[model samples]
Target chain A: MSIFINKQTRVLVQGITGKQGSFHTAQMLEYGTNIIAGVSPGKGGQNVEGVPVYDTVFAAIEEETVDASILFIPAPFARDAAFEALDAGVKLIVLIPEHIPLQDAMDIMAYAQKQNAVIVGPNTFGLVSSGSSKIGIMPNRYFVPGPVGIVSRSGTLCYEIVGHLTGNDIGTTTVVGLGGDRVVGLNFIDVLRRFEEDPETKTVILVGEIGGSSEEEAATFISSSMKKPVIAYLAGRSAPPGKRMGHAGAIIERGRGTFESKVKALNAAGVEVAGLPNEVPAMIKKILS
Target chain B: MKLYEYLGKKLFHRYDIPVPHSKIVESPEEAAEAAAELGDVVIKSQVLSGKRGKAGGIAFASNPGEARKEAERILNMRLNDLTVEKLLVEEKLQIEQELYLALTVDGALRCPVVLASLDGGMDVEEVAEGRMIKWPIDVSIGLQDYMTREICRRMGVSGALQKEFIKLLPKLYKMFRELDAELAEINPLALTPDGLVAADAKVTIDDDALYRHPQLPRVKEKTDLELKAEELDIAYVELDGNIAVMANGAGITMATLDMVQHYGGAAANFLDFGGGASVERTAQALELLLGTNPKVLLINIFGGITRCDIVAEGFVKVRESKGIDLPVSFRLVGTKEAEGRAILEKVGIKTFNSMDEAVRHAVDLTEAS
Candidate 1:
């Protein structure tokens, strides 16, 4: 069983009429995600890939049980879609829009907290719970059902690392992409806490990058409360300061959020950190053995 | 999207935030004219980067002649690899105190934050001396006057100064919101005989939110390579290393750079062909990376929204079109890996399933060459 989603998890698609929304909706259906309904403001009576569409999240929830909602709205309108999902009582919201205004991200964060909900990302690839269910854009073939839990700040980086693990016969219970935006909805600490509590997830693998203090914060939490053995792989060691490396959050500023700092913090917490993604599987095998 | 100092000050003036009268000048003669118009002015080199004062990009002029000389020297200065071509001539203020104030989003907190310090005109990172007071602003309610006063009190600000801070905080917060700025800072809000004035301005408009502000104060010029990358919708940054690294996602791209460096190879550039890029767009991304002329090219793609076969198609296209002879190594996994590898194999371009093998091979090639 996964921490957030599973086979029984009924999902709804927000902005389901848009190109990405429709495309991923079909993909999720193909993966057997229990998609209950869809939302696309004016396209209420229509259906996307056999999933019923409603005008608003509130209207969609009135008819079908939507435990989670995947938002494919544009960056400018992503905040409104998140609020709509929260107001409609959808507990888990996965935001797919990148380049969301910082102010809007902050508001979304505050509102999500107030509603006691989980918002994955404003620039994420979403999450998948291996063979049983998936709610994101990640290719399902790379993931297999197992005890290792993966949480990362990137999509392709997560894919690469998970592929290595799966190739080594290490499957994952769930893989979560926390997004690469500066102001993301959830941090490493939040996911780590959940992973620590999941009995099915025996060990955790954190895929981090340079930029924010989330990795440091996660390390702090692991040193204090985490009992599960965790392996970490941090990126951007050679990245120069003051230059944003692709991701808005992947920059070292004022000597803070450097690769050395993150590695030092993680190592201090007794978490074995790998220098590269491919080294993770061997380290994990060593830890398990 | 960092606004020049003169432009940032213009916005401060528009918002009724007190700032010295300033004029943008190109040459030393224009700077002298502007300095003469304003008495005993300061000539500041206009560059996109910060720490200008420490970099000698900021200088004071006692008179118009001195201003002209300062402009000549500053115009030829380079700070953080950016040449200063323009100068901001402004009337110098009689400062009684220099206070630090800024409004920016704290990524970890996931909220807007207001930072004020008694010590000013220095890097905020050096504010570990206990003079800095930070208050996280709730974006729902914004930076209220009460919150500003509370922050001022926490920063040991009192009397007329506290009142001025209370009045100024809202305007600064408004600028941060209305401009869609990622960072809005006044390094030294000087308190002088006239009033509280912004001694320096730094406003970085969110590149994604730039569409909202069409009539920006000035558009910072982009290099030809940067413009080309923008046209192709790929995140590209040119570096001074020997290995060209390309990946499908930002995190993976950065990790690839780090791995290349870890294996004793310096990456020449950082390029991420963001998710779901089409076959044609992927080809264009590869072509753009080829323009950097690195010793070795390393392509690591773990397809999610992006398809691995599409990336393979791009490699094939580049080889067929430009006929690349440089040492190239790639790792393809996830989303049609077999098909992607077959495409590469058909083109006689060997592919690796392991990122480590590919990175090590590329780094070894760079060393061998």
Candidate 2:
């Protein structure tokens, strides 16, 4: 079974009526997610793609048995939506907004943890639980049900890896995006631990990039307790120091954050590291074979 | 999402925390007036970004003439990549104890952390090595009484300042919450040799939360450059490159930039129509891209929300509409991808599906030129 999302996970869209919310909700419905309800302040009585909408998250929660909430709300209201979801005791929250204020993000993170709620992003594309359930905005065609569990920081890189794997007939169980924000809710280790315990997940593919000590922390976690064979790829190998390659979190300042350091750490920890995105599926195949 | 230092100080003043007496001036006339108000003032250029000191964004003026010159220099100049459109003239404080105080998001710990140090001004980051007073403020419950008390004890701000500091901490937290600020900082809280006073203040508000803030002008030119071309409407951040990129949607633009770097080519600029861009907007984009004077152009689009033919038509019209004639490369996918290609193919625009091929062609143009 997929860890965070599955067919059993009844979901609610916090911003069901907005342009992004409506589009993704329709996509999730097409992908077979149990979208139980939606919440928007003014458009409560309206329906979005056959799903009921409520004025408040608390109101929506009272009416439906939803396990998780996917927030497609804009950045400014991200904290409010997350807090509302947490107050309703949602087990998982998928936030698909970028450029959230650092203070608001920090508060939301603290609030989510206090309420025993786990959030996926403040700048993320969401997650796809193979063929079972989908949350966020990741392209679904790239995935197929398999033993490999994928966790990545980049949204499109996850798609790039899946494109590489899908062509080779390999698939993923659950692809989790920790988001490419500097201060995201979930980290690599957090998703990895969940992957480790899932019986359906025998192998893992991690799509990491240059920046932060996240990859190092993941390497340490894998070295200590992980049993699954994991093949991973870290982007920005050619990226020079003191250059930010678009994503705010992808910058390598001084000698602290670089592609080489991450690759070296993962290799030392027994993770079969793909030198590039194209090399990932082949490495995973070689290890599994 | 950053508010100016003066705004932060205004909030501080409302909270009863002492901030330096300051005035924000727009013109040279106003600059002189502000300096006169302060008497012995420090004329500081007010740009949004940091590293102002390095770029001559901060200067002192002894009199009105000097202040006007400094303001004139600052207003015309870019400081930390942001234009210094305004200057802050503040009554200089008597130097005494300088300390750093900030409440920010600590990524690793996954919490709201309060950082304070006895040292401030130059090299504060150096002194923040290991023993700085750090208070882990809870996000939902906010800064508890005990957390602030412990922070006060470590800061050595006890006695009369304890109650004042306690009141200030909550107010800071409140301001952070109410404004949706990313950072609320008071660096070198200059005590004027008197023991306590905030010399400088900084605030950064979240831009995404602007739905409620109607008066908040998007500082970037949300200009009516729209009539010119779709390319012009797109926010362009010029980079050191010969290959100009025109991409639909922000994410794809980012990917195109990465792919450009991967193929050993630097991106000229990042231009995005966001989503659902039209023909007029596309031509506008082309005109803007051509302004960079790049050797080649890469137009990457996955037309899910946008039509390929519409974008292609815009490129064709760029020469006629904006008088931009440039060698261009493109990769069009998703809706009407074939039709879009036919239009571009007839016009001699280079086309490729693989990002690898597109980047290679663009890099070749740069090398040949």
- Taking every candidate in turn, the Cα RMSD to the unseen true structure, in Å, is 1.6, 4.6
Stretches of candidate 1 off by over 4 Å are none
Report how far off residue B248 is in candidate 1 (Å).
Answer: 0.4
Top candidate (lDDT): 1
Question: Where does candidate 2 stray beyond 4 Å?
Answer: A14-19, A36-64, A74-84, A97-107, A180-183, A208-216, A227-276, B1-11, B22-89, B109-111, B161-164, B214-235, B247-255, B272-287, B302-324, B334-350
Question: Among all windows of ten consecutive residues in candidate 2 chain B, which has the lowest summed lDDT?
Answer: B221-230
lDDT of 1 by residue, A33-137 (tens): 999899998899999999999999989888988899999999889889999999888899999888888778888999988899998997899999988888888
Lowest summed lDDT across 10 adjacent residues in model 1 chain A is found at A98-107
| All DockQ scores | 0.82, 0.36
lDDT per residue (tens digit) for residues B1-369 in model 1 = 888888889999888899998889999999889988999898888888777888899899988899889999988877767888889898989999888989888988888888888888878877775678889987877778889788877887789888888778889899899888889999888999877899999888888887678888646467678779977778888888988888888988888888888788889999998988888998898888888788898998877777888888878888898988899998887788899999999978898878889999999998899
Q: lDDT score, residue A199, model 1? A: 86
lDDT of 2 by residue, B256-360 (tens): 676788778888776666455788887767777677688888887765447788988888888666665656677776567799989988967657875557777
